[model samples]
Target: MSDWLDEIHWNSDGLVPAIAQDPTSGRILMMAWMNRESLALTAAEGRAVYWSRSRNRLWRKGEESGHVQRVIELRLDCDADVVVLQVEQLGGIACHTGRESCFYRVLRDGQWATVDPVIKDPQAIYAGGHGHD
Candidate 1:
């Protein structure tokens, strides 16, 4: 029998864009890439797991930080290229920049303006490092 993972149309990099959304508020928390293994792990573990292109490995969401995303639902777009994950953000923070969402910048007069405040200092969240992988 064919596997469910086979249904996805991965890109040339063998990855798809995964969007994490807050189930309660419907706010987009973050966006990351997911490979076959990471998507399987995320489903099996009931948490968010992404493929880190920079690190070239599986990145478990909140592996370092204490802000794990409890996945409530997983949805694939009609094209089978994009995925949307409904999750409960444990620490009320999502962005590596310490904001609730990665979409913290807004266009104003053709300039990017920061709209969301940092919920926690990135220094505090990453522990000696500056950002997430």
Candidate 2:
């Protein structure tokens, strides 16, 4: 039943790195992991669903913060070990840090610096300690 998933070269831990990107801007938002169930659910739901390694369960994007990603397309890398999800990020937020994307830091002077301003306060986005896994 999961023949499509079997084609993916999952790591020894049974996980594949999944990247979420903005379809319009072609910007990489964040990187995550997906298991067979999550990957299948994402395809069936037309949304991004990731396997939360920290929580050891399925994590649906925007479930905690209302920044759900509507998947536009799903692509597999040449190695078949990585997945790229082209999506329209709802509410324009994809990071738990209240940033548009998780990759808001830039390497400068051999140091990491935040280049983007927080669109909203993370405290307001997440009601409790559920901000990060």
Query: Best by TM-score, which number?
Result: 1
lDDT of 1 by residue, 1-133 (tens): 9998999999999999999999888889899999999999999999999999999999988888778999999999999999999999989888888889999999999999999999998889999684683
lDDT of 2: 0.92
User: What is the per-residue lDDT of model 2 for residues 8-103, given as tens digits with 9 covering 90 to 100?
Assistant: 999999999999999888889999999999999999999999999888999999998888999999999999999999999999988899988899
What TM-score would each prediction reach against the true structure? Answer: 0.96, 0.95
Clash-forming residue pairs, model 1: none
**Worst ten-residue run, lDDT, model 1?**
124-133
C-alpha local distance difference test of each model: 0.92, 0.92
Candidate 1 segments exceeding 4 Å error? none
